[model samples]
Target chain A: AQSVAQPEDQVNVAEGNPLTVKCTYSVSGNPYLFWYVQYPNRGLQFLLKYITGDNLVKGSYGFEAEFNKSQTSFHLKKPSALVSDSALYFCAVTSGAGSYQLTFGKGTKLSVIP
Target chain B: DTAVSQTPKYLVTQMGNDKSIKCEQNLGHDTMYWYKQDSKKFLKIMFSYNNKELIINETVPNRFSPKSPDKAHLNLHINSLELGDSAVYFCASSQTTGGSQPQHFGDGTRLSIL
Candidate 1:
């Protein structure tokens, strides 16, 4: 089964400063990685995904993630942080073959302070 | 327009009661999924349906059953609800069977068992 890990439980950053949420995955084959954000009392919204091709994948809300095959990491990154970006973030992965069900991380609570 | 929607945004019921959460997708995706988010904010896949057929059924309790009448809808029916069943239930849909495409999610149904 594919699995994802978010090492940090919370990440605090200042507004306008670049922020990052770390994510790693363990899968048998080429992994399909994804990043999602969840606001308070809401469902998780899809942010971006990495299937193949470019290592740097840009997504919604001016967020991007880099897929590192050697490091086995898919970290979410934003050049500038905003208070609105403060929310729970999750990393997910699915194996290349077999079940397409995504395995998600525990989630990281991001707090962007002004 | 909302791509995915779920009925009863909030559900409050006593233990031993039964409840059902309805989900529908307007994106015309062939695959639909049910996910459970615990208090700790851990998201896990509960079930998945492809073309109205049960495709992925996780280790969810037998009391929880999913029904898919068509490709556009997948509803979750929980029997004899327990306190442990209290959590946020989310419905999502994707265009492809594989994990290449990012899944779109609904707001979610927050079930509170008392």
Candidate 2:
């Protein structure tokens, strides 16, 4: 079975500081990973996806994620945190062997304090 | 333009009542899906339709029925609303059912059962 794990329930960072939201996964085969962000009372917006490419993937809103196959991790990152970036982040994974539905993590709430 | 849209952003009804949430995607995708987010914010795939055919059906109860009139539209109908059904329902679409196609999600509908 494919699964995703988000270790942090919440991540706090100061404005203009670098931020990271941790994510890990367990899958039997090659994994297609994705990152999504959700604001309060809103649906999720796709941030980026890693579908067999360079380790570093850039996404919307100045966000990026590093895909580490050895570490089994795909952590979301931002060079400089913005208050507008504060939202719930979800890490999802799907197996390359015909698993079309995404296995999402519980999500990590990111708070950028001004 | 909204790539994916869902109707009734907020719905409040009594137990035993029936309700439906409409969803449409303008991205010309071939696959549509329904997901439920529980109080703990755990997102789970409920059903999926590809080219108006049932593709993925999770372990959801039969009370939750998803209808896809066409490739661009998918709607969810609940037979009998229950308190446990009070949560956010999201409609999503993808270019195809499998492979690395990314799914686009709607704003979601908050359903409350009194």
Candidate 3:
């Protein structure tokens, strides 16, 4: 079974400081990983996805993720954090050719303090 | 225009009552899905429809039935509402020609069971 694990339950970062959210996955074959952000009382918003691309994938709102194949990890990163960036982040993975659904991790709540 | 939308953004109902949540996508995507998010922000795929055909159905209870009238619309109808059913339901869609793509999600419906 394909599964995703977000190690941290919450991450606290000061405004203008760099932030990172950890994510790891276990899948049978090649994995298509994605990052999504959810605000309060809102559904998830797509950030970026790593299907078959470069190791560093850039996404919305000055966000990027590094896909470390050896580590089986795709950690979301931002050079500078803003107070409004505080939200729930989810990392999802799916088998490339198996299922169309994504297996999401227990979300990591980001708190950006100003 | 909204890419994807779900009706009844907030639903408060009593136990044993029946309710339905309607979803539609104007992105012209060929695949649509339903996801449930618990309070802890753990997301799980409940059902999916591709071209108006049932492509994936998770281990959800039979009381939760998803109906796809067309490729652009998918609706979920619950037979008997339970207290456990109180959660946020999201509608998502993606364009799947050969490989799956990043899904676009709606603003989710918050269902409260009394």
Q: Top model by DockQ, which number?
A: 1
Q: Candidate 2: where are CA atoms >4 Å away?
A: none
**lDDT by residue for model 3 (B19-103), tens:** 9999999999999999999888789999989999998899999999999999999999998999999999999999973334889
True-structure Cα RMSD, model 3: 1.1
| Runs off by more than 4 Å, candidate 1 | none
For model 3 the local lDDT of residue B103 reads 91
Which residue pairs of candidate 3 clash? none
**Native-to-model Cα distance after best TM-score fit, residue A67 in candidate 1, in Å:** 0.9
Instruction: Give model 1's TM-score versus the native structure.
Output: 0.97
Candidate 3 chain B: worst 10 consecutive residues by lDDT?
Answer: B94-103
What DockQ, between 0 and 1, does each candidate earn?
0.73, 0.70, 0.65
Would you list the rank order by DockQ, best first? 1, 2, 3
lDDT against the true structure, per candidate, is 0.93, 0.93, 0.93
Off by over 4 Å in 3: B97-99
Q: Write the per-residue lDDT of candidate 3 for residues A37-103, one digit (tens) a residue.
A: 9999888999999988699999999999999999999999999999999999999999896568789
Error of 2 at A9 (Å): 0.4
lDDT score for residue B60 of model 1: 95
